[model samples]
Target: MKKTAYITGGSKGIGLGIAEALLKEGVSVAITARTQNDLVETEKHLKTIGDAEVLIIKSDVRNLADEEKAIQQVVDKWGGLDFCIANAGVGRFSPIDEMSAEDWNSVIDINLTGVFNTVKAAIPALKKSKGYIFTISSLAGTNFFENGAAYNASKFGVVGFSQAIMLDLRPYDIKVTTIMPGSVATYFNGHTPTDADAWKIQPEDIGQMVVDLIRMNPRTLPSKVEVRPSVPPSARK
Candidate 1:
């Protein structure tokens, strides 16, 4: 049977990398985000990777209704869902005193509550198929820093929320994992990957990691994975 996967924030960067890798392996994957242009571009790129097994969905993780609809569409088209990846996230880096209410809420809404909505929306189909879930958290989730208060809080919540859900869903034979990546070269925070960023982890590395996790033995569950660049820019210099 052909397995199906749903991914949030799948238009670019790590999400797109994962989608491309899965599609290449013949996984019917659906990716959702709010940007129409990015979705169009990603879908086109993915088509070159495989057949027309990729679906582009315009959705915002902050809205439960949107997530529910996106999941339903994939399930309807694919017969079932075997994987759900909560990778949509945003970062607002400002000191506690300088951040506004909107800044805090935006980060929390997309990075924290967003994961809640993604997994919650997929549970029914996931329960039926004994699916696997991957939460794209950050190393900042565990380590704290100045000028990163909002981002840190949201990622920390992601780490905690996913850990708790792993327990909740384990009884149903559903596997949950949180991926805390360190310094990946991607388009996060409006920055593009370039030659200068070569020392950081590549999005494709994380993509391959997801495939490896899903391919692991059914009896084994690696619920948390932390991936970092083998060498930092400073060390490489």
Candidate 2:
């Protein structure tokens, strides 16, 4: 039987890439985003790929109610969830002195609290499947940079939260992994990915990594993965 995977922010970017990768491997996958039209369109595109079952739920991770609804819908349709990718996130960078409290709250709500809601809603199902949970963090989670205070704090919290959950869920046989990727070529920060940006990691690269992690031996848990471009811009320049 095909295992089921659920992902947030799955309308595009790393989340969508992971969905595509798992679909190719014949896994039933559900994807959620904040827009219904986008979810419908993504569902259509995914159907053309393989026979994997696809469920599209329009959800804003910032809303706990929306997250619960999406999770319940996936569980109802797929029977159980074997994997979850809490990949929905946003970034708004400015000097800490200039950053508004609203911006900080929104980022924390969506990035950190949203992840908490996703995992909490899915835990019972994940526990049943002896599943895996993944958080799409960033290098910023570990290496702080200027103007990244809010974004860094949220991701850093993700790393810590996921690690804690890894220990909490071990007795239940569920695996947890945190994927910290550096400069992926995705439509983030209002920047669109282009062919010229082949030097950066592709969303599909992260997707492939997720698949590999899922397939690893149950006894071997690579709890944290830090991936970076083999050759960075400074090295090339």
Candidate 3:
């Protein structure tokens, strides 16, 4: 039987790349985002990629009800979900003293609580299918720097949450893996990708990694993975 997957924030960046990869592998996919326009455009682009079914859902990860609805829509359309990717996130960079309460809340709500909502909504279906869960974290989850208070706290919480859930879900044969990537060339944090980003890790590279993980033998599980550009700009002469 053809597998099905659900991806959050799938309109662009890492989510879109993962959707493309899964579609190429003949997995029917459902992608969610907050904007209807982006979802519609992404659906059109995905259709051109392969014959796999693409369902675009307008959803905000910060809302548990929205996430639950998104998951139900996928299951209603595709029967069962074999994978869930919690990739919706945002960055708010500022020192604690300088950060607004609104900015801090937005970052935590979307980045950390969002993951909770996505997984909570999908757990039942995943348990039944013995499926996989992929949470996107960052190197900043572990390494903190200046002006990164809110972003760091959210990602660090993601790492801890993902690990704990990995153990909790493994009992049901549900695989949970957290991927921490550094310097991906994507339109994240208001930065547009350019030729200069050629040296960084491409979003598709992370997508390919997901494909590999799905194809791995069931007996082995790589619970946590950290990926970085092999050579960063700082390393260049």
lDDT values, one for every candidate: 0.92, 0.92, 0.95
lDDT winner: 3
lDDT of 2 by residue, 1-237 (tens): 389998999998999999999999999999998889989988989998788899888888887788888888988887888999999999999999999999999889989999999998889898898999999999999999999999999999999999999999999999999999999999998998888789999999999999999888889999999999999778986
Candidate No. with top TM-score: 3
lDDT of 1 at 7: 94
Give the lowest summed-lDDT range of ten residues in model 2. 62-71
Candidate 1: regions farther than 4 A off: none
lDDT of 3: 0.95
Instruction: Give the TM-score (vs. native) of candidate 1.
Output: 0.97
- Runs of candidate 2 with Cα error greater than 4 angstroms are none
- Residue 35's lDDT within candidate 1 is 89
Report the Cα lDDT for residue 46, model 2: 93
What TM-score against the true fold does each predicted structure earn? 0.97, 0.98, 0.99
**Worst-scoring 10-residue span by lDDT in model 3:** 1-10
